[model samples]
Target: MAHREPVVVTDEPTIGKLVVDASRDVSGLIQKEIALAKSELRVSVKAGGLSIGLFAGAAFLGLLAIIMLSVAIAHFISFTGLDLAWGFLIVFFLYVLLAGLLAFVGLKKVKKVRPPEKAIGQAKAIPGAFKGKS
Candidate 1:
């Protein structure tokens, strides 16, 4: 590749030349920033969409697992010689018990999840620090 000599601007350049150079530089900078932002947004959006899709798939599989578990339990109960109707009723009772246990566990978890107090205090202190500095 042939290398060309760089052009040099004189100290006594015309007003029009300065204006043109500044405008070109500013427009190039803006175009570069826009391209960078667009690239970042594309990557972030793709990852977010894929994450959502995976979560949806997980939820669907979890529902299937629950259905399979209920069927298995019902079949196990019926193995004891009880009628299918009675077995299903027992499964329903077991489901109710499981639901109550899950609700209690969820409640406990919610109670344990306190706000980020230290983080909040530090964030609040930021404005004060900035004010004092100014």
Candidate 2:
């Protein structure tokens, strides 16, 4: 059975107004932080999902490629007059050459894929970059 002192007075609005303004400011800041957190979580989840999907797709295609490659090698050996061992060796060497070429091209493409600047732009300016700003 205890009553707390009145925290707000009708005649003096200055303190109450300041408190209200501060609360609003704090609430706005909290809301902005929550929004940013949600956006970042969504982006991470999307990137993870994309990575998993790509891996699955690549695995499926790779399996299919293996099947086709075996079939091609078999057809080459049967239809052509070449010996089975020579046919297999030729096919294997061609596959290795193609793989090397693809790896080189892939490396070039990977080298060109620079990360977006938006994330780095949001980071605090380090001493080096802030030297001229100050």
Candidate 3:
């Protein structure tokens, strides 16, 4: 009988190389998940920012409007010889109309803004993840 030694194959990837490759794959997956989360939050943040900005703008407009109305009423009394009481009444009604118009428009825009579609998609995706677990 002749003794034979086993030949070793050197073509296979080493465990170290496999681990490094798997680490890269896992890191890529994590990056993708982070990106998706950021994208989801971005929409909510943008909507919130827009709402806050519009509210602030409306407040500033209201202040400027008060100053302008006071000036106009003063001018009406001084030049048109109108009584201050009548000037005040007219300016007050003008302001009431303008405020109503702005409120209407703002309400319309708010009502038109539907919930983000991503929320619905996420809701649907949630149950699917645990479907076979139980």
Candidate lDDT (C-alpha), each = 0.93, 0.86, 0.88
Which regions in candidate 1 have their CA more than 4 angstroms from the true location?
1-20, 112-134
Sort order, TM-score high to low: 1, 2, 3
| Best candidate according to lDDT | 1
TM-score of each: 0.63, 0.48, 0.44
Candidate 2 regions exceeding 4 Å error are 1-12, 32-36, 43-47, 100-134
Where model 3 places Cα greater than 4 Å from the true spot, the runs are 1-72, 132-134
Using TM-score as the measure, the top candidate is 1
- Cα lDDT tens digits, model 3, 50-121, are 999999999999999978978787677656887777777777788799999999999999999998899998
Model 2, range 43-77, lDDT digits (tens) per residue? 99999999999999999999999978876886678
| Candidates 2 and 3 compared by TM-score, better number | 2
Better candidate number, 1 or 3, judged by lDDT: 1
Residue 69 shift from truth in candidate 2, angstroms: 2.4
User: Of the pair 1 and 3, which is ahead by TM-score?
Assistant: 1
Error of 2 at 49 (Å): 1.9
Task: Please list all clashing residue pairs in model 2, or write none if there are none.
Answer: none
